[model samples]
Target: MSLRTALIVLTVVSVTADTMILPFYPQFFAQAFDVHSQAHVGYYLAACCISVMLAFPVWAKIARRVHELPLWVITQTLAGLLGIACYFSQSLWQFWLLSQLMLCLKASYLMIYPYVLRLEERDKHLGMVGLFAVLMQLGGILGAVVGGALLEHYSARSLYLWMAASDGLQVLVCGYLMWRLRQGWQAPQSEQSTPTRGWTPHVIRLGLLAMVFYCAAFFIRPFFTPYWQSLNPDSALAAVSISGWLFSLPGWVALLGLWVNQKRPGSDDHAQVLLLAMLYGCVGLWLQASADSALLTIGRIIYAWALFQITVRLELWLFAHSEPQFYGQDFSKLHLMQNVGVILASMTVGHWVSAWGYASTFVVASVGLLLCALCLLWWRQSDSRNAQPSHS
Candidate 1:
């Protein structure tokens, strides 16, 4: 296979492995260890996020020192092994710790983004980035569907085994890519200064906006399966299947967003697009907070569309603004900020849900998105004013 094809395939398999357990997380914890607390689920998810946040920067540093393909092969293999170990976890705590281990090892897959981008012309970055996002969403869709079915028909342990299998496939692919590139591959040169760059005002604002956006979006994630069960108590299998479909439906909309981005390949109105998306997302969150199941389904679809567009635009903005050589480190910093937001949501939403219920959590999440929209609007206005010359 060509290098591009290999990268794309690796992206699909790596994301599939990473997200395979998402739909069944709550169910797995409840079934395996009889741990039913939403707060506990939040804490576990937070732990996973924290592990990835810490591990990403480390992986970026290691990427600078190691050749990309070999490093990816090692990490993918180790992640697969750790995932298998997680399958045998006997307790909730054991599973949580093993999960963290898997995530830490798996974090190296993130380097693929910058690696692939470096291989292409700068103008192609947005299209390539959108393609990467679309492939990731496709992988997520497949993972959610397969994971839900496995959890419902088979055992929770099967999901871990499947995840491990996916990682193993990635290892083989990366190993092949490493061998194929051996002749022409050069290690990335060491930077004269530290990789970390000073945060510009625009970057700082974007980071804060991303933080709020993620926090709002993920507040309900850890408890989504349980919430679905609460709504449709008739059959566990049906609930799992429906939840998987609901999660996967967004990918279709994301594919549409990718098509649109292809037609208009620029960041002329990214701020406006982002603000509009947040508004739509907030409306979706409110609809979800309602008691009607139909409305909830519609809400999920709406939220997914907005999420797909927002993420694609945000990544384009990052690539457009940052230096090419620093893409890996810069993207890692953005990922870290986003995960910190998720961690904040995971830590607080659990208590909020435990107290006031899921609807209240949704309401708070909508409010958070509104605040993000306002921040973006203000930042844009300030930017426009700064761009204009003095009248004198």
Candidate 2:
């Protein structure tokens, strides 16, 4: 297979395995470990995010010394092994520690986006990014569905086994890609200076906005399993897993549809699409927090769609402005900031949910997203005005 094909496959499998854990999340934390409250799931999720966030910059530094392909090979292998560890976790703390190991592996793997972008034709980059985003969602949806089925027919332990198998397969794919690269394939080098170019104010600002949106959107996710359990005390783990699958569907739809259209558009179009998506994302947040049952599902779907679109557009927007050679480093910074936001929000949301209840927590997150939307809106307007041609 072509390198791009191999990379896409790896991306799909890695993402699918990661998401499979979502449905079993609340159940695993609350029931399996018999945690004291629903919100404790956030602490577990936060632990994982914190490890990944802390490790990203380290991975970025490592990439500077070595190459992307080798880094992924090592990290992906670690991730797969950790999945086996997750299978044997005996308590909440054990699960949390195992997550730390998983994050170590995941930190390097997430940077595959920038790596893949480097391999693609410049003209095809944005659309391919979108396509990749869609594939990610497809993997997530399928993971949830399959995870749900696994929970229905077997124990949660089985889910981890599948994750382990997926990660192991990914290791082989990474090895194949490296072998192909030996045959004259090389990543595009960044033209910008390493220090002054990456982590710029503009990049940081956009990344921060994206991260905030991610945090607000996913703050509640760590608790979803427990929330479902609370809502239906008699519900089987399968029902909870199905809900996770359903929640991921809209995201996949949005990704597949818009990603194909994201050719090399003008900066103005990029900004417009991103801003609109963030706005809709806020609306999605409100809908998720305010609705119930079927309506809640619809809200989640819209939120997923908006979130995925904004995320892809934002990545494209950053790539457009970046010096090509610095792609890996800058992209790593983006990943760092995104995970930091997620980590903080996940930790904080646990406390909030524990104190205020699920509905109220969602309301608070929705409000935060609305504010984020407003900030981005203003940022866009300011950029437009600044770019206007000066009169003599």
TM for every model, in the order presented, reads 0.89, 0.82
The lDDT for every candidate, in the order shown, is 0.79, 0.71
Candidate 1 lDDT at 61 equals: 76
Residue runs of model 2 more than 4 Å from their true location after superposition: 29-36, 85-95, 183-198, 220-245, 259-268, 289-301, 354-357, 384-391
Candidate 1 Cα errors over 4 Å, as ranges? 90-94, 183-186, 190-196, 223-240, 264-267, 390-392
Candidate 1 lDDT (Cα, whole model)?
0.79
Clash pairs of candidate 2? 189-325, 190-325, 190-326
Candidate 2 on 302-323: residue-level lDDT in tens? Answer: 7777777777777887887776
**Pairs with steric clashes in candidate 1:** none
Q: In terms of TM-score, how similar is model 1 to the real structure?
A: 0.89
lDDT of 1 by residue, 128-245 (tens): 8888879888988877766766766788776888888888888788777777766223455653243667666656777888888888878867566567667777765346657756
